[model samples]
Target chain A: MAILNLKKIGVSGVNSALHKIVENSEKDFEIRNPQGQHSIACGINAPLNVEIKGHVGFYCGGMNKYAKILIHGHAGVGVGENMMSGYIHVKGDTSESAGATAHGGFLVIEGNASSRCGISMKGVDIVVGGSVGHMSGFMAQSGNLVICGDAKDALGDSIYEANIFVRGEVSELGADCIEKEVRPEHSAKISKLLKSSGINANPTDFRRYGSARQLYNFDVDNFESY
Target chain B: MSEDIPKTHPRKSATFDDYTLSEIRRAAATGIYDIRGGGAKRSVPGLDDLLFLGASLSRYPLEGYREYCGTDIVLGSRFATNPLKLKIPITIAGMSFGSLSAQAKEALGRGASIAGTSTTTGDGGMTKEEREQSEILIYQYLPSRYGMNPDDLRKADAIEIVVGQGAKPGGGGMLLGQKISDRVAEMRNLPKGIDQRSACRHPDWTGPDDLEIKIHELREISDWKKPIFIKIGGARPYYDTALSVKAGADVIVIDGMQGGTAATQEVFIENVGQPTLACIRPAVKALQELGMHRKVQLIVSGGIRNGADVAKAIALGADAVSIGTAALVALGDNNPELEDEYKKLGTTAGAFDDWHEGLDPAGISTQDPDLSKRLDPVTAGRKLSNYLKVMTMELQTIARACGKSHVLNLEPEDLVALTVEAAAIAQVPLCGTDWIPGKKNEILLS
Candidate 1:
């Protein structure tokens, strides 16, 4: 395993070193002293294990693909943004817009997530251990967001086909987002996702939320809803 | 004798014409408003209202045959380690891949590369073909963050954060379902066959202070190599320019109301933002006041048609000009040859603005595979390059006539406005008069 110390090399130097490593498709990486710097490990394409020991700033692991990134400390806004076909594990809390606009990825936030979590998410599967702030999964088109803890107000506003599974106390749903029956098939999927995320929660404990389907097709009779 | 005279009925009011009546009727018939491409259709003060004062006696003109007038400009020299050095002072404005066919994007790239200038990867991120074709590609960071990826950000020669556009300052852009091809849908991370509306504001940052940080972050991401440009719609030019300068922009792009878009509400297009003619002077003033004039390059866009417009913009203290609508026209959009097809679509050639419909005959604006195949990128690219060459030569001719050694040396003193409104906005003297309305008192006091 190669160890990258941010304090010694600086942000650009470390990032460049990581980028070169990814380009070469090398071994696992251990990053130290991230020191809340932004864009840590961004644009990494090759399959590798990247472990950051300390806190990171915004856009950490952004545009990640075919890599596994594990952040030991808290992350700032837009963590794992626009990631495609990767796995990101944030050990601590994350700021707003976590996993935003990500198409394909598995993001696991071990701690709480701020507002707009999974906002505009396309196909990423996000599992948050702690509570999520308001407006989580706003305009989510695809994928699944499994929140282990309580959800704040206005959750899943203007959501599309994406599924939301919340375990704790309910908050108000946003426009077009409504509670749905958690069938056996959904519970099975939740169980698999929980296992993949390494969460111990029972799948049956959660409730599912999704688009009301009233907006799937526009009708002049439903004009006011628009 | 009376029968021999042709009977003439009361003429329709020029102010409330056929098109106006049609628009009203259409609006009433359909609850939703019209969304289309192109800029303001209304006539306003533009570069056409300005003319250069050629040198005769007081100023000596350069011999057109022997003398050389330079047009080279270096952008993003303020803070960027690697700046873009262009042979001409014109760059292609951002047009998204989703809004325009891939062939059109490639054509834009080819033309800009041939002309030794830069092209932009507009809203929907950068396509691989566009990246490979464009010599110097500027990546536009828009509000939606659609298709924005770190790889493309690193690949760009420069990055432009689009705060607003001239056609619709505060309005978001729309990509109708028809234009959202499979590739476009994948790039934008949206479902296929669904209407997509980009956000009006960025999700992360709110205002100027946040914008400053965002710019810093981008610089770090690109290793401080690429120049960062702040593009704003021409609303409050002075304030926006000043704020952009303060936000650490290496370059500023002010787009006027005449700037075209892929699709936006007609109301926003025709009734929003200031004209290009009224945008340049105030922006220049802001730069000058901040002691950053020429240090941070200014690229003005919107309704820039010919070489005269380019010269006029440069004379008014703009370092460069960007073209969008004109560029599309150069690439054979709304060509006269496609007039019959356009008529079938219920519009004429030169008036074709319904780009969101995905039924373009010229194939430049649509996502339909059959329609897009109509445009041969190679031929269209050559045409664009030829147009660019003509404009460059025209700019040189004007510069030579004005006795300027370099295009950048052309100043406001060499221009006179034909209209009072233009004279006031451009701060140039009206024809046959020594007065610019707002500046006369300042000149007298000075």
Candidate 2:
């Protein structure tokens, strides 16, 4: 597999190189020292393994399909944004807006992630091992947000159609972000997800949160003047 | 101590509203006339005065107001097209709550819906009021992605990727630090009192190459069903339109400099952009060269005043026209009743545009409680609807006068340009001429 030294190219030229890697490389490829820049690995539908080292800018693994991307360092805003179907792992700290609006994928951030981690997330399974920032899953429509560590603030503001489980302190819950009963239906699934993500945390320590469906159909009676 | 350079010296004195003194002050401040945004601010010939040359031997004029004037349209007929079916060509332009007050935006949506068109939400997150009132909501995907969600994207009738706006072409948004209320702040995930600085370039895209991927990401996020539109400020629009089409945009929304905003630097407003008059022709030219002219429905905005202007814009190759300033006016902004308030603000009626101050007397311009109360959504919405209907009728009258059954049927042959800029860009003929460059087709204007 080819090693793409990202410092050698500008942001615009990176896509072609990644596309070439997807076409040419059979095994996982390695990219080194990528400073914060946009669109590191976009629209790759192949079932390939890609590792990006160093801080990455927005949309690192966006529109990803079938490929598995691993970022070794910190990530900028909107990392793994809008990923269709893939696996994205951020080993270090992440900036605000990680995993924004991803349709279907598994996003795992090992360290702390800033606010709006799973904003408008769709059909993705996000697992944050460390503490998560404020508004972690603001307006999340579907999918799941699992925080093993402390959740800073507004854990799930204006959330709808999403399953959320937080293991630690939630500074504040967002509007319409309500707690739901964690019945026997979710026990097996939660435990399996925690173990697979390499986190041996107790499933019983987590509490589930989701939408109240209050703002779905806006009416004078239902609308809250916001 | 009375020093040599006194505080009240001639140099420090007011020149009594003297034109020359003000001119000197302006000249000292800047070398040229200061302006901003992307529309024509200079006085150039417009479609208002242009009398169409109806069909003589080959073409004929339809009875004015009697014959049908078809204005129906569907965008994204090209490679990357929106899947929406529109009954009318006119659609509401995206205006943010941070720009225009909450009420004004609601009124625009009301008007658009009444006219069987679509309304769009801007940089701010979707307001429940807008979603409830608007029949078809075109949710905007801005760089900030404020309040963006997969559910909203899927729920929207269409999605517009706003790369830039006409008001501050290539410049980031600045809704002054003062306007950020608790709600606005909460909506944007910003500090309550901090200046809202938007990144001019989207974080997801570094250039056209990345834009392609971003579009794909959006398509993936939305499950590839909703129509996706790429909006650009009218700067280098010829290439912007073509490249956007290449980058997988189903529809291209081209906004010219004349488009209004709630708040922009005064310097940027008057000086930065080509007039809407100049933007249309080049965009159409680029579309024609790519052979995607009418295929990619072009929606043009900026300085659209009367129905005649709308008709001209469409004849010049726009599928429809979107208005911001006009729509606001229809809702009683600058109304004579607010003259007292205008006087208090050091301006007069019809001249007070304190849109920056958020003290809108007509609720259509401000989020203030007393001011917002002045604007009854239902009544104001109806007025806006009436205005839109009148504009459409005027356009129909013009189309019929040009002997065309449909607004789109009014060809370029019906127009004549008085200036070279107008001629070259608008594709209209020189005044008193059957002679158009490469006039290989029917000559009706002669």
Candidate 3:
């Protein structure tokens, strides 16, 4: 295990140190004093275990692949953004666009997440512990977004093939997005995601929401929806 | 008595032209607006209105065969560790694999490699064949982030953050169901036979301030090795250019309304943005005001056709120019050879812009198996290389005639405009007079 302090070396040094780790090494690293700095521990390509001790800013752990990152405090916008393959565990709440456009990854937010969570997610599986704000899961292409607590307004707007599992009430649904029955397979999938993210929740208690697919092809009837 | 009879002269309304009337009828019949490929077709004051002022009695011209005029340029030298060194100032603009056949993308890569320039990937992510064929490939980071991954980002030579395209400046990209094959569907992570509309704005961040941070993240991802380019449409060129520079871009690509799109509404194409001729000077002025001219490179595109357009763009203070529509034309798009097939599709060879239909006879802008196989990548690549070579030669000829040792040495003083609109837009003097329409000068040619 190696210890790197952000206050001591700055963002560039911390990133360089993370990049130096070899692929599949599964190395352990502890970063101290993140100080809400942006882009800390970003672009990690190797299979390493990284733990950030304090709060972080935008794009923390962005485009991360093959690494397992644990954020000890709150994170700002776009954490784990565009990540290809990795595991990011945020211990506290996150700001808007959390896990935005991530292709493939497992992002577990233990606390509440702000608006636009899981927006445009390609294939990542995100499990949120607390409530999420408005416009969550907007335009999600392919993935599973599991929200254990209540969800705010306009949930799953313009969603694609991705599935959304929400436990509590939702204010509204966006175009082409609708609530569907939670089947046995969905329960199993949600259960697996929750177990993997270490969240204790009954899969049957949640409802599945996805695209009605009405807006998939352009038609004059759906013009008002657009 | 019948011989003395006179017939009333027939007249037509200029406002309701033939094309306009046809469009109105078509819209009334089908409740959908027209969607097509390529750029605005209406004539605008562009490079054709400008003429090079060759060497006269006051200046000496270089020997055509003996004197050397350098065409080489280096892009991304401002902040990047390793910049692209090209033998010419012409580059291939971004065009996606979903909108175009894989063979077309490969052909563009191969041709650009042979021409010693770069090619860019578009909305649909980078393809493996394109990566293998291209010597220098610029990965476009778009709002949709379709097929966006870290492995490909690392594989790319440079990263271009696409804020907006010229064809639909404020609008998003649309890939109709006809063009979305199984492969394209998997890459974009969408249903196989559904319309895909990309977001006009990026999902993660907004505004220039956020863009600066986004650029930082990308730089960290690439270890600050790759050059970052910010591509903007012709709308608000001056402010956009300055903002891009402030956002830590090593290169700024300003695409005018004449730039091509794979598929977009015709109204947005014709009604949205400024012409190529009207966009350059303001962008250049922004760079000069910041004292970053020549430090941060500018690559301009839209309506670039021949070598004259290339030279004219450089003289207007662009470091390089990119071609999209012209490159496709060189690769046999809308060829007269396919005239019969085009007519069968209810359009002439030169007027075939329904690329969204995916029934292209030339096979460049299609995903149909049979149609796509018609275009041989090697042959098409060779044709594009040949066209690039000719354009480069023509540019050198103009530079030599203007008594310049390098193609970049050509300045605004080396050219004169034929029309008042051209002179005003290009910020150059009108021919036979020293009058620039918008500028007030103390001394004038009398």
Q: Please name the candidate that would achieve the greatest TM-score relative to the true structure.
A: 3
Restricted to chain B, the TM-score per model reads 0.97, 0.87, 0.98
Q: Over 4 Å off in model 2, which ranges?
A: A1-78, A82-226, B1-45, B55-58, B79-82, B435-446
Q: How far is candidate 3 from the true structure (C-alpha RMSD, Å)?
A: 1.5
Best by DockQ: 3
lDDT of 2 at B15: 50
lDDT of candidate 3 over B1-446, digit per residue (tens): 69779987888889999999999999988889999999999988888999998998866788886899999999999888989899999999999999999999999999999999999999989999899999999999999999888889989999999999888899899999998899999999998999998999999899999999999999988889999999999999999999999999999999999999999999999999999888899999999999999999999999899899999999999999999999999999999999999999999988999999999999999999999999999999999999999999999999999998999999999989999889989989988788888785543663
Q: lDDT per residue, candidate 1, B346-403, as tens digits?
A: 9999999999989999999999999999999888888988888889989999999999
DockQ of 2: 0.06
True contacts kept of each: 0.22, 0.05, 0.86
Measured on C-alpha atoms, candidate 3 has an lDDT of 0.93
Question: Which ranges of candidate 3 are over 4 A from the true structure?
Answer: A23-26, B1-4, B441-443
Q: Worst ten-residue run, lDDT, model 3 chain A?
A: A17-26
TM-score between model 1 and native: 0.92
Q: Report lDDT (Cα) of residue B212, candidate 3.
A: 96
